[model samples]
Target: MSAQDRLVGAATLKRLRLARGWSLADLARAVSTKAKELGQPLDASVASVQRSVARWESSKGPILPGDRYQLLLAHVYARSAHGQLALSVGSDFSELLYALGHLGESERRLNDLRTLLVRTATDGGSGLLALLGPSTQRVLADALADPSKLDEELLEAMGIAIRDVNRQVGSLPFVRVQLMLTPIVESCRRLLDGTVPDAVLLHLRAVAAQAYTLAGRAAFETRDDEASRALYAAAAGGVGPPWRRAVVHMSHALVTLYSTPGIEAAQQLVDAAVRDARAGESVMVRARAHALQAEIAARAGSARHAKAALALAWYDIDSDCDGDPSPASFSAAHLRGFEGLTELYVGDPSKAHDYFAQSAEALHTPRERVQHAIVSTDQALARIRLNDPEAATELLHGCVDAASATGGRVAAIRLRRARAYLRPWRREDWFADFDDHLIESFGA
Candidate 1:
């Protein structure tokens, strides 16, 4: 209404758009295109643009919530520049720039930003997002002027934000995020030009491993199993301790088996993971390796081996970590869910249900929650085994929908397989739905 109000709104919009590294023209084009796609005619006048685009970006105006569709578009735009920069500079610097680009004015500070840069640049790669860059120092400093505010809580908050953005949208549309790693790897190469410290190199290697792991997970979700296996293998060879290496190798083995190729090779890799776990120090990592081995053993029809792997995982779970029920090193809640999955696969429904419930309750992260949903699906299968097809179908449907919500294709496929198995006993109408879901889930 007032000029002052309009100016404030415009300034806020300008600030947010800049933070996202988008220009006014870019924002206007996006708005117009989105409106057209929605079958709404854009007025396309200066006044209309000011009222809509400005208000959308403005803090004073209503902060429009992004649905999955809009968020997917935003991620596309964000990662385009991010990927290019990563290739040019390296991940360490690119990641910092990303943090800076996203930070609100209140979140920025100088010295704190410097400290973060120094810590990440020095430490052997800690947080998931820390792989971005040293410029995070400036970004974090600007975001939190008071040094005290940049604690573990803040780091977790940042990790959660990144995960939310990456996971909420389906994986198909957001595949570009994986490409961003190329620039990151390139940047690391430039940063290590010559005579780099051993610690820094180690940290860089650790960061690269994480980059590969992230890319591998993305590939796995997209059913590019070979790509996933290759990325996980690279990650396994990167850095950190033997336990971390073993975990990565175990992940590689899982992806390879999922690809349905060479069962003997997959089994050999699993066996190696088991041997590594036995020799490793980290209880959490050992537990994960064993859990994965258990899943592989089950799939390979080695019921005895599966049970033994499950027992090893449970033992490690009970012994490791400080918290009650103990958190997995990966995430406190994820470990619990994996344990539940192991239980279900080993034919212990009651125990599986208890662990699944715990994981479901404790999960806050999107990925971890998807894992919980898979456990729930396994519970549904257990119900089906007991002849309650109706109850089992309901649970399966719920889990499948939840997995789809998070873009978890692997979990969706498993649910579809279960549904297909139930098709014979169900009514004819259900057959069509089951068939459609199976095709969609498997892309067959």
Candidate 2:
């Protein structure tokens, strides 16, 4: 450890305070106010808080404040950091602050949506459909005219279109699939809104569920967590068939795992997926559910649970089974990707590298660009762990273009992680060039 490391806690506290041009008293008021807003309501008044701040800034003070105070401090600093919160506190603290902030923002948005729904209920929902886009409005108008014609043939046609859109999501650019999905979902909304024959209500509900599932996937890939959750909720409520419900549950589990600090919630979702997959008797969907469970376990740092889940996943995939009709695809390549990611989290890097290589090899010809970027990043991280920094750098360099072109938030996040792993080599000429290339591609 360096001398700076020894003094960082005390010095950083003082630096952050002075950087904001906050007097001790001013900071005390802010902290107290934020605490009350968060429902913690600290008992310390301004005079006591001012004294406490002085002690914390002194070299003789405790290394950090108590937990409640730390939370308030993080909230106070995070409000003004503008994405630089990690620099003020540390990564762990910054993560807590970001999670809290996202929760608050999402809660507010949810309340607004609830209010809209209440008003729509009171006002007969006349203007709610009008809030759709021009293209959506046009499509809705056309669809609403034939609300009684939702026959088997028409439903099959819609199913084909939905499957086509689903196939395009990981294969085509995210923005393209997203553009195609909005109108389809809005059309579904119109179908559900217009007067329809009761005989086909269940089928129409299933169709709407599929559209919402696709929209949820699009929103998730683009990092819109709130929209993803809402869409997943809609999909879960209306989806028919256990296998389809399993798919929706697993998709919801993934976004929950990534976006919130709710590991238990994610676990519950994955468990529900597993149950539905079993009830549906789909070996492939069951295998995917187990794989998702492994991912959740890995995220929770439980190597034993992750390994057990992966074992079940492998067993299910290897078993022979009748053909399934669900549109959600899960193959050996995806399983290998799951294994690589799990190992990267909880096991040895050499094993992760082997799994990633298998995943890459198993991908179809003209491999999915977004998947390529994500797997390439996993491979690069494994290389870094194996002490092959140059090879890691090369792997990351090859994927930046695809990631930038596809504009997948998952790809961007993985690339950022890879870049962080290379920070120790930042003084090297190659590192400098790669850093510049990454920044240029992803725009910070």
The sequence of per-residue lDDT tens digits that candidate 1 reaches over residues 36-89 is 664764566534554555444555543332232233233223233444211112
Give TM per candidate: 0.57, 0.66
Per-model tally of clashing residue pairs: 21, 0
Q: Could you give candidate 2's per-residue lDDT for residues 93-151 as a string of tens digits?
A: 33333333322324333333323322332244222222232333444465568787555
Stretches of candidate 1 off by over 4 Å are: 1-182, 185-199, 300-304, 320-364, 426-444
Error of 2 at 51 (Å): 94
Model 2 per-residue lDDT at 361: 70
| Candidate topping lDDT | 2
- Model 1 residue 368 CA deviation (Å) reads 1.2
What is the lDDT for 336 in model 2? 95
Q: Which segments of candidate 2 are over 4 A away from where they belong?
A: 1-143, 365-367
